[model samples]
Target chain A: MTMRSNRIGLLTALLLASTGMPAYAGEQAVIIDNFAFQPAQLTVDAGTTVVWTNRDDIPHTVASGDSTLRSPPLDTGDVFRFAFTQKGTYRYFCTLHPHMQGTVIVR
Target chain B: MLDVSEGRRDALKCMLWGGAGVLWTVAGGVPKSRVLAPAMADETGDGNFSFVQISDSHIGFAKSPNMDTPGTLRAAMDQVRRVRDSARLLIHTGDVSHLSHDAQFDTAAQIIGEAGLETHYVPGEHDVLVDDGKNFFARFASGAPHGGWYSFDHRGVHFIALNNVQNLKAGGLGNLGAEQLEWLERDLRGRSASTPIVVLAHVPLWTVSQEWGWGTADASLALTYLRRFGSVTVLNGHIHQVMQKVEGSVAFHTARSTAFPQPAPGAAASPGPIKDVPAGKLRSLLGVTAVRRVQASTRLAIIDTPLGG
Candidate 1:
């Protein structure tokens, strides 16, 4: 099953690349470390699911502006996944520490 | 570093943090600090009334430096019980639960309720996250003015409970939303400037560290209203450490956590718990702050008492 999914993800990436779109894997991971989002800014293709894994000792959340995403309190080692099916820019922040923010440009 | 008595060790630890044994007194709009031992400091001061401030219990947290959060809170409660005869009431600054879980709130209520004293609470960002404070307000705050913010009078002192954690804006610090600010303006209206005002919230009203998100965003306007008071004591938590600031007659203080200790401002990369606390040294890092004022005393003394020493 893993091999099958990998092939399908690669095929989808190829199709998006042929259309002159940002080629991104179907799944992307963002690390929450040091009370900040590692990338802080990300560019992902449509239909890509973004996963945020909390690596810091404290808890955080990935909450979006237009309600595109909302994660429960994520403790250390916990993960919150959201699929960005629409093509738009998404802004999110950790409600617990709102100073920590990020932007996702979905193409 | 060497074999020393627990009391002396605590004194050393307190010296490093600049917290314990320092009695704060505000006279004629000027603040003064004098060192005193915690044991001697607890004596029924010449003040007419005294209350307790407990904060950042962070129940349901099981991690380094402190494995059992509830256990530390219980121990801290024991210290409070010891002074039940002298301490008139209890004020918890916030963070009653780590994840705002139902069982976590239940455990906190069960333990704090044992004090058998009326406890007033404000919502921490953590407590309001799970259900927008549905669980927190239901259990700890009912009929609270302006949604988990209210004001009460005790011993001729006016206590204002402000909730700066709710509706926090993105890329901003803790916020007392616009509606709540409007309510606060109305609440303070008609009160004389001589009223001793005590403001309680989870986040420090003063900017302790902007990078760490340890302050409230709209606190400047709130302070504008409070600065006129003769004696204004602003007690806050969520930093998990003791910090103080005095501007004129208004004194701002942040209490230590009962669960675990976080690094001082800018001391660590993040404001997370200090995991490497030396073995047998955790209790000294955790403490409860007492707010007391003697008869005819013009200042409110906030003393931090460690659970162990």
Candidate 2:
């Protein structure tokens, strides 16, 4: 009986670890590295806050092609966060290095 | 080494050639550029004092064409040491580091400090990427304004360093904002019109290439204030190449990078480092610029010398 309860507790801890702490609601992270966005495509629900963290040594920017969304130059370890309000596809590229591209889909 | 010939109405034609050295002479408010052998640039100007301008070090960058950025910077510094006696003051335009990391800034600072010369700096877009230039301002622009713009006077020449990288727009044109512009107008109000004004910024004050975001927005207003001066020399370093233009009394020149060279405007699909540069040609593409005060004259002559030469 005690062993079963301990196992259940372990399972609960694993589930919590996988789903993350409850304090943060609908937060997603995207990494900018190697002159390109890691996981170039991201999907999240509406009202979710998406944070872009630059890991590359060089500077980059997150700018939408249509001039809707734009970010200042991001150095290494710099973060730019935006909360999606409506559902749509957001495509972006680094204005400094335009070859680096990424996409975000809000559903 | 200048061959000055009369053009239309007192206009001088500047003939510059790759691998062929050129000397620029400005006298009596007229500009003349002469193309000679490559080594002639080192000893062309007749000036009592000279200063060097190095830009775009990009210290922490780890990429192709030039992964060892610090090594390249050290080489550039070696070139500085060679011209140490002539070029006393050093001015770095921007991009001290590839990333705004503390370590990157620290490394670049140590390397630049080895030059042992009085150095002036203005923050680049890369330097302000993290924390909005808090790290850069604290290190280089201490006691400066909130946005890190400042001015100083040296050897009868007034130097104004402006920060235009703040509050960048979607089009990538740098913004100087209203506050700085007002400050600049007031700063120049009391100065004499005969004073040789040297204005330094990270991005070109003039429009080099709007599509590449090489120009500063609202720079015309700044130029308006400088137009009164007899010799208004504008120096900048974001494009990582040598480009010059003269608009009336204002002469705009951009310096090359000490790290890597970027493709010319519209030369490539994107404006980044030239990755496919030939193995031995990298150092030749990167170098330093020197400005000298003409002897017994008020004109300031500019000499751009590459590292490889």
Candidate 3:
């Protein structure tokens, strides 16, 4: 019975590892549209991955406030993902169009 | 028509005569010889290689600061001609019109042409409003493939006109785009690094302020190409203010507007007309810069003189 239980535990661990699941399964998404960012502000836990999808026809990008973090320009159907490792309110915007703005709050 | 008394008529005539005499005195009397002599001296000094920088003309504007839009533009043109020296070039830095209207462009062209000099232009955000810069490209795309960015050699100095307002960002630095970046890289490939490069564009390459719409999108990429050149002078005109920055081998300068002046960054509620000044002081608020490359070194001395100075 102990041998059978150990096999079952190993199988469960392997399954979890293969799935690539985060510890808390925390992730978020934001959309860019019509010269503006939908849900312009978001709050997520530390280590959460935030994905920005460009729904507008034109190109856009997410650049950090101090201009440190920059995503490649995203056309329609393009997406950019950034993992929030630090805890702070980070404001970003489309470098191609300055009026479009969004914020990612990691805590 | 004869409602007034003879005495009142006589007084009015006397007043008119007195006013005409004062006007004559102001125009043609006294030591007016001194003013004319100095003007002649200025003309002599201006005979050298000089150019006029008219930035952010913003024609077709219907604001209170200048309701008669064309009139104010004509006033600016008068100022241009008053100080314009023979054999000078006219460099317009962008925003020649407000809405990219054909009529506005025509008017601007007429007024600028009246200065009677070779005019070079770069498009502004207002100029690229229609057809993905079709109008602006059609009008000012000399030797440039894309939205009117090109380089030319003139009088031992290199002049590069770049377009940055087409694909712009809100509060971000201007961009030269990838294609233009590639072209710029290739264009500068054969040129010597010691060439004095004067880069003119619509938006400032340097970061003026991120909160307000005073910066460009991807200016760093273009700057990377420019870093190889010695004495790189980057001139832009979006902010409509006189701001200068010098960063190790590059000097960035922005000229004042030929139209109305916007408020200083972070000073007003938003970027618009800054009121509360006396009426006669309006012209002093706006002006241009005269840049001259001194001999021997790659250094340029710029004089920012206010309008009617």
Candidate number achieving the greatest lDDT relative to the actual structure:
1
Which candidate, 1 or 3, has the higher DockQ?
A: 1
Worst 10 residues of 1 chain A by lDDT: A16-25
Tens digit per residue, CA lDDT, model 2, A1-107: 99999998888878866875332248899998766687899988777889999986567889886766777667678899999877799988776544467888987
Model 2: lDDT of residue A56: 68
Instruction: Report the error of model 3 at residue B298, Å.
Output: 12
- Tell me how far the alpha carbon of residue B39 in candidate 2 is from the true structure, in angstroms, after superposition: 7.0
lDDT of 3: 0.63
- Candidate 1's error at A55, in angstroms? 1.9
lDDT by residue (tens digit), candidate 1, B1-309: 754575455434433322222233433433233322234335545454656778888888876655567666776666666556656778889999998999999999999899887888988888987878888998888868437888999877788999999777788898998788888899998999888788899999988889988889999999888877777888888887766666667777777777777777767887877766663564444333344332223353434333221
lDDT tens digits, residues B34-118, model 2?
3223243355246645666778888887665555677667656655655556565788899888768899899989988998988
State the fraction of real interface contacts model 2 keeps. Answer: 0.08
DockQ for every model comes to 0.70, 0.11, 0.12
TM-score of each: 0.82, 0.69, 0.60
Sequence-dependent TM-score of model 1: 0.82
CAPRI grade, predicted model 1: medium
> What would the per-residue lDDT of candidate 3 be over residues B232-306, giving only the tens digit for each residue?
767788776666666666767676665555566666654554434443454243212222322223243433323
Interface RMSD of each candidate, angstroms, one decimal: 1.0, 5.1, 8.6
Worst 10 residues of 3 chain B by lDDT: B20-29
